[model samples]
Target: MVLTEYLSKEALEELVDSFSCAGAFELEILSPDGEVLARSPKVHSNKDSSINKEEDFIRFELPAEAEIFVGGEHVGTISLRGLWRTGQDSSSTSVGVKDSSNLALSAERQIAISPAAWVELMRDVVVRLCDLSKQVRSRVEELSAMDRMTNTFTEKKDLKEIYQLVAETMVKVTGTDACSIRVFNEERTELVIMAAYGLSAKYISKGPILLSESKIDREVVESRKCVYVADERTDERVLYKAQARREGLVSALCVPMIYRGQIEGVIHVYTRRPHQFDWFETSMIQGVASQAAWAIVNARLYHEALQAESIRRQLRLAGDVQRRMIPSQAPKIPGFEISTIYVPCFDLAGDFYDFIELPDGKIGICVADVVGKGVRASLLMSSTRSALRAHANYVRDLPALIKAVNFDLWRESEISDFVTLFYGVIDPTNKTLTYTNAGHEPALYIHEGKIRQLDVGGGVIGISEDAEFSQETITLSSNDVLIIFTDGLPEAINFEDEAFGRERVYAAALEAWGRGDSADGIGKHLLWEMRRFAGLQSRGDDLTLITIKLQ
Candidate 1:
């Protein structure tokens, strides 16, 4: 049929200027919904320049296919089809064109399309539609799989489960022949394979591979970017291309897994045939890798915390053992009254005290503060106590005993481990109490209704690893009392960070010596004052006190 049809200015121009005389030509276009948007020719135009150019041309949008129109007449259909860049895109199909005469035939003369033409046209339409449908379906499937893979990673917490899911889901989404995930080691200096599918674990987990020179790993690791290879044979920079080709791998994608702004590992996929990797696929892989990275980090953190808890429990047990080693009560002296209080700041304390009576009517009292807290500190304190007690029996003089203990402590402990000590020997028979303060706080004496502090002692033990110590003595009369303690007592502070200074210690001593001179009451009163001053809050360090009263 020779009908005048409206056409776009450009199409009409092209047909008139470029195409041959046409007795009849069909034109078709699609609507927004992909249906055939048909229109007939309005009138014949011999290059009429007066007609509205805007109104003469018709355009339709089709999700599957579209056809251009001129003056409302059908034209050739145009379609956009897509396939994965894989070499498998080629296919064969039978095509048939519509029989236009059948539509205009009278009931009888409109003989059914010759069986051959009918089949041809039907087959053509069906095949085209099927191809379009398949392309759409493939894209939808990929998107669905990407979403599902991300969901699975978020729901799963176990590393093994996550790895398996990642491998399977990624392979399905990308249609890859194999997949693997490699994680960075603790120091984050190298990448170690953590999981794989369709790949040997031995190859993956052999050892951590350094990033500096690793051809394949370095690309993704250094870039913190995704890498893709469409045809290994054509890409000279690809690592293990020979192995990949031998294994039928023609395409690959590597997505780096990042955690907390660092590249933790990479997710790799391999296709058995040459394929195209586009922005969409790269985005999908990165989305999945991001979730996987967070999951791996969370799993590792949980595992590490469990290990630390186990270690902490063991330390608590060790602290209990150390506590058992300390004597619970003070030893009785022949003619002296003694009271001692021991407090530990943590599960185990670095501070310790020991009381030993000599054969010549004398009592030795020792209070020491180890430099640190916890198991190491407690162990060092234990060693110091044992060595000091052994040497106490050999040295009758307090100064010599302290010097020996300092030497032993310095020798037995590590460079960082040291002790500050206040050691004293009370001679009730001669009314004299001698003491040595090895970097320790001065002792307070309440005698003749007066208060005095003895501040003479040697430097901290273990500083030089071999140091000597000296002693200071105070002659006590009847009704005199002496207070020997670690710095924990005088340095004790309240929540305000105020220390109970020497003035307070002196005042407490005077009050006790005046009020019946009760050593036990004085020690208890001092602790009570400290507790009240601190408002029953946490004590930052150990609190210890040793008191001796002369009758």
Candidate 2:
């Protein structure tokens, strides 16, 4: 049988090309029967060396490299000869056998060996070529499997289905009796079986595989490579010897599925009898492990995206509900202009503001900020809003009202959780304001060119049930403006990480008041100045502002 039948045209040509010396005649590898199998490129500058017929090229015996065998007979020794016009030296005779396929005696100089020595030399080259062929075929098989696995993952098959496919395919590829696909549980403390093939249900139900219990898996995970056990009976790493025996497992190979330097999972292959894995099986299984890791990562990302979408929907619903807690527009109190804006950095915000209509032409204005952010903080803000609203009309005194709200919040909130609140009742008929600030940003009161921070309340609400609160009463004056805001406004960061602090807040509000802007106009001007100072910087918290002017 010809070697070409066993090796592809490309493979045979590759064997010849490797032997093509620079500035030399192209080499032709021929079968033992003198049939041409492969020819290297015309490595020589001249194309004149192309042979017109197979007989025209002289062939030399390579002797058996013992590479190919059929039916107990050593077969197909490789041979090489130059692709040149058959010739003999007219001026000087060569010592080799006279064949019409030979070039002139000058070509014989390139060989520089006897017929026997040349055969020995060709034998060595043939051995190396066969070894290289085996390696190339192994890599090709591995790459083909990898491509199939990648496509399987890209198709977005169900993650469980992919796990089963990988388990079955790995067992088939490695010719193992059983294979199991396992991934770390959420806590990373246990390896849960995702898929198993060729294993009995009784054996698989052997209990949890903890990372702490198995030295074998720990080594695989820590080493980030394949671990092989020759005998399950004697191996100390085999934590389940009895189970392995029941399952008819002898030798096992375990490989870690690693992606981005993190080991995601493990794939185990077991043979019923002791069997050592070759390079081909080991490399192929490692490739399978890597592909498995990729599938795992993709599956996790997909699930996380689904979870994020669900949370977003719930947040929108919650935000809508909490937004209702904010008055649709600032309360239109007689003898006063009220303007308010609530800006949230995220979909859900911790900041909230409300205008409660109290008895007898009195309007209750409150702005509060929960201690944290996001859904948790937003929920707390909602709770605080309910508690404050519940007591706002019932408790007539400003200090008593704040104390009641604080006690309620303290009863319901965690030790670290609290709300900073500013609540006030403005009686326009009497031109009097009764207010309390509970560890909140002080209300900026501008009365006839005099600036005062209404900072009288108490420690923040929800920390202590017995927290004391103090009330401050002031008589309203014409053209006086009051600004109440959450800490986000003054603590707003700029690109340089500097804060647009209380000074800036005071300046902006003072400038707008000086310009004789209406309450709504002043709120807009303050927001514009805040945005200007915090140019292109991302806010980490929510901003809530309320502007009140005695018109």
Candidate 3:
């Protein structure tokens, strides 16, 4: 509770108006710093009073002072001054003299009668009015403090900021030297200082306060009640009595911060002189601590939610960048039709594919899958794609190009990272397909109702620095269909723990080929069959497929 809370400027002005009217004189309300808060009406001063300079006037102040109090806090003083016209008779036309003309005339007409008695009566009346104003202002200040505390708790949403605000506000309301808040450790074995105001850095750096050693703090935590010490130096319950004396802290009030039926911490208010905390002061501090607990809890929750949202946004951005690395549509080659599909189980995928057209009208195709999932795996996949593309341009031999890509991957990748890739060069004019499979799923070649599995290549990339690779060539006849896929299709499992194995894939591909479906249609049909087999089970890995049909 403070002065401004009880007696606002507007309310003080109204009081000044009432006092001036009753006393028939001017009044001014001055703060402790001599700043005028309210002033009564001055009739003659508002106009030109220089013309009447020679007129005799009696000016005097009230004998008694009227002290103002707001919730036990002395705010300012109210003074009264009177101006009486002594030269004129009782018929004087001067303002503010009409009401007190008889008293002035009595003092002037007789030397035996004194105006001291009349001044004493006026002082009594003003003192009574001032006492009444103090009572009213006290109530107003109490209510205002409570309202402000409630609003502060509702508005602030950061834990550290809320702690600082609560500590500072408590110090102001209680008129204490300093305030501090300390929260319990997670293990409930110690109290750690969280926020403080009006305290020196050296004082705050006092070593950790163990709960067992600090009696007052332990009492507040265990009993969930406030404890007060009027003399810190003499109280046996004070833990750091020597340090408190050194800091000139004479009194302390410790209040528990309870939230959801559990005591979380304690707020301590320190006074420079020995003083007993009254019921009003103690209750006000406890109220502040209660609101502070709620604010601290809510702020932490808000921060966690914000962090989760930020991570979600980053994942979305990474997924978009990874998708763009893959070809949007299959490249168009003369006498060949190609189609592809890629599905990632999560936001970011470990699988990627690309098609690069060489200078001799031949096209290079690549489909690779990293070992892991998520962001790390996606990063490795991107690096592998760049290395393969760079080496494929210069190294025309399938085995040599793959070996160069492997060396680059081994040099750049981590020990746990590896990629299984299948790359091929298609020469439509020669009707020959040259390819190397680096430990990937074997490519299926279907021609004239016969199926051939091509599995001729070295191990996966990024496993060894000097691993050798080999290539295989196959001649394509009329109406030949080639299917390249990752292991996701065969490894897809249902609720019954059954995998959609290679046999099922072969059967589906055979049926699609017999139906005379195009390359796109065949790839989609196989994917649909796999989904049907999984039946409500989530995808366990990334799925990718590339199909080429020679017309």
Identify the leading candidate in terms of TM-score: 2
RMSD values, in order shown: 12.4, 8.7, 12.1
Q: Estimate each model's TM-score.
A: 0.69, 0.77, 0.62
> Per-residue lDDT for 85-184 in model 3, tens only?
4334544444342343344432323322233443344435544555666655654676587679778778888788888898888887667889989998
What local distance difference test score does each model get? Answer: 0.66, 0.78, 0.80
Q: By the TM-score metric, which is better: model 1 or model 3?
A: 1
Stretches of candidate 3 off by over 4 Å are: 1-150, 158-160, 170-177, 181-194, 205-245, 249-293, 307-311, 447-452, 495-498
**Best lDDT among the predictions, by candidate number:** 3
Give the runs in model 2 whose Cα sits over 4 Å from its true position.
Answer: 1-143
Over 441-480, each residue of candidate 2 has an lDDT whose tens digit, in order, gives 9889998776799999898999998999999999989999
Of the two candidates 1 and 2, the one with more favorable lDDT, higher being better, is 2
Clashes of each: 15, 0, 0
Model 1 C-alpha lDDT per residue in residues 436-524, reported as the tens digit of each score:
88887777777788877776778877766457666777787767777877777777887778888777777776777778847798888
Error of 2 at 378 (Å): 0.9
- Model 1 residue 551 lDDT? 62
Off by over 4 Å in 1: 1-169, 172-174, 205-207, 214-225, 229-250, 259-263, 278-280, 357-361, 397-400, 428-431, 493-500, 507-517
Q: What does candidate 1 score in Cα RMSD to the true structure?
A: 12.4
Residue 84, model 1: lDDT of 10
